[model samples]
Target: MKIMFVGDVVGHNGRKAFQKYTPKLRAERGIDVVVVNGENSAAGKGFTRKSLDELYQGGADIVTSGNHVWDKKDVLEFIDQEPFLIRPANYPGEAPGKGWCVYPFKAKNIGVMNLSGRAFMPPLDDPFQKVEELLREMEKECDLIFLDFHAETTSEKIAMGWQLDGRITGMVGTHTHVQTADACILPQGTAYITDLGMTGPWKSVLGVQTDKILYRMQTCRPVRFETAEGPSVYSAVIMTIDDATNRATDIERIYLREEEDGIGL
Candidate 1:
């Protein structure tokens, strides 16, 4: 089975790029499932119903999020109803949405789990312990398991990848909108990457307007950040898993760009 995991979708540009490329890529690569991180899908921070619907229409089977998931106050309105949209599992006491879900794909149950890192992030429940609790239940009900670790520190992300190496089908890190070069299969047969990167403007500062971010950094003051415009990039990773063993056999990175003329490459 093959599954595609898209990086953080930044905003309007990100959504447009996703809508344009995901279907073609899926068809060309024979992807059976598509997972996208939509935390920044709504104007560069937080998700809205419209953004979620757009992603679904763009071929996202599961939408995951990170710290920015709650930036939109209205998320509480529909989070419970959307089973495919998930927030970080480590969020404190009785959050609005779930952190993981299992869906029947083909003849097997595919479980997608989301967890947040505490280091350099909100002080939430320990992700290591939270995943351990979920795994006990998920292993019994699912054939394949995938995790999206929305984190900041590479060390933390790498630790989780090693911690769950043989147990899960694969794991990918999100939150940091910069794709890492180290995409590889672990010794225990799990596919891992430090980050999948941002699916937004290629010439911006992590999807935000380059000038705006520079001004904020230089002045060290509160300045509004907006999503960048112009040429966009689509970042993702595709994983091939063994059906019988439920282990990842191969993993490949994807980085495509769309020019102003609407030509993508």
Candidate 2:
């Protein structure tokens, strides 16, 4: 099975790029499923029902989120209704929506899990301990498992990868908005990457307008930032898994900018 994990989608531009490139990518890579991080899909910081629906329409089979998942109050009302949309599992039990789901693929059950890192991030339940419990339950009924760890520190991401090296089908990190160069399979066959990168503006600061960030940096005063408009950059990774072994065999990284890919789309 081939699954494509897209980076965090920012705003209008990011959504446009994703909608434009995903179909072609599926055709080119023969991707069986597409998972996208939609935490920043709503105006670059949060998920609204409309934004989540847009992702579903753009070919996302599952949508994962990180710290910004709850930025929009609307999410609290509709998150529970979306089965394929998930927030970090380590959130308090009262938090709405789940952190993982079992998607039926062909004849196998594909378990998709989302977790957040506590280091340099919001204080949530312990991911290291929480994942083990969730894995035990997911393993019983799923043929393969994929985890999207939305985190800040590379050390924490790498450590989690090592901890679950041979246990899961694939593991990929998100939230940094910067794509890492390391994309390789672990010793135990799990595909891994530090980050999938940002699927939004290419020349801006992490999807925000360059000037807004510059103003804030230069003055040391608060400045409202907005998602940069115009052409976009698409970032993602594809993991190829062996059906028989239920393990990843190869992982491919794809980073494309509209400016170069197709003349600013």
Candidate 3:
């Protein structure tokens, strides 16, 4: 099965780029499933129900999120009703939504888990232990598994990838909007990458306007960050897994350059 994972979708521009490029990519890569991180989908903060619906209609099969998942209060109620949307599993139990879900893929059961890292991030439950427990339950019924490790530190992401190497089919990092150079399969066959990168203007400061970020840093004053609106780029990864062995056999990074035609989506 071929699957595609998109990094953090910034805002209007990001959504447009994703919608414009995803269909072509699906055809070009023969992607069987598409997963996207929608934490910053709504005005570069958190996703709203309407935004999530738009992303789903745009070709994402599953929408994942990170620290900003709860920025929108409406999601507290909407996530439970939507089976394809997931938040970090390491979050407090009282948090809204679930950390993982299982869906039927062809004749096999596929599971997706969302996890958060504590390093340079909000304190959360132990991701390593939580993942082990969840995998044990999923292994009983599912053969294919995908992990979205929403984290900041590269060390944490790499450690988690190695920890679940042989147990899961694929593991990819998110949250940090810059793409990393490490995109390779582990010795145990799991496909991994430090980050999938941002889906908005790469010329800006991680999808935010550079001036705004600079001003805040210089003045040490409160400032609201907005998504950069300009020529952008979209980054993602496509993975092919062998169902028989539940391992990723092939992986490729996809970079889409967006034109300045007022955003495609």
Candidate 4:
């Protein structure tokens, strides 16, 4: 089975890049499932209903999110209704959306789990413990398991990878918006990457307008940030998993850029 995991989509440019590249990439690579991080899909902050619908129309089978999931107040209204959209499972039980889900793919159930890290991030429940709990519950119901570990520090992400190395199908890190050079199969057979990178304007700072970020950094004062415009880049990773063993056998990083003409350059 081939699964493609897209990095965080920042705003308009991110969404456009995703819409432009996803379908073609899927066809070219024979991707069976597509998971995207959409926490910043709504104007670089939170997700909106329209943005979620756009993502679904753009061919995302499941959308995962991180700390920015709640940036939009209306997310509380529809998060529970959207089974394809999931937030960090480490959030409190009363949180609006679920943290993981099992979707049927090719006559087998595939479990996708989302977890948030505490280091340099908002205080949330212990991701390690939450992941263990979910694993125990999902192991029996799914043929393969994949995790989106939204985290800040590389240490935290790497620790999570090692913690569940042999047990899960794959573990990909998000939230940093910068793709790491490491993309390899673990000793235990799981595919891993420190980050998938941001799928937005490549010239900006993490998808934000460069000037705004630079001004803030230079002045040490608050400055509004807006999503960058112009040419965009799509960042993702494709994983090939063995159906019989439910282990990832290969992983490859994909980075495609769009020219000003809206064509992949």
Residue-wise C-alpha lDDT for candidate 2, range 58-173, written one tens digit per residue = 99999999999989999999989988999999997788999999898899999999999999999999999999999999999899999999999999999999999999999999
lDDT agreement with native, every candidate:
0.94, 0.92, 0.88, 0.93
Two-way lDDT contest, 2 vs 3, winner? 2
Candidate 2: deviation at residue 5, Å?
Answer: 0.4
For model 1, residues 47-95, the per-residue Cα lDDT tens digits are 8889999999999999999999999988989999998899998888899
> Which stretches of candidate 2 lie above 4 Å from their native place?
260-265
Regions more than 4 Å wrong, model 3: 259-265
**Global lDDT of model 1:** 0.94
Write down the TM-score of every candidate. 0.98, 0.97, 0.95, 0.98
Q: Write the per-residue lDDT of candidate 4 for residues 1-265, one digit (tens) a residue.
A: 9999999999988998898889999999999999999999999988899889889988899999999999999788899999879999999768888999998987889899999999999999999999999999999898899999999999999999999999999999999999999999999889999999999898899999999999999999999898899999899999998877778999999988877777776
Q: Rank the candidates by lDDT, best first.
A: 1, 4, 2, 3
Single out the weakest 10-residue window by summed lDDT for candidate 4.
256-265
RMSD of candidates 1 onward, in order: 0.9, 1.4, 1.9, 1.0
Model 1 clash pairs are: none
Ranking by TM-score: 1, 4, 2, 3
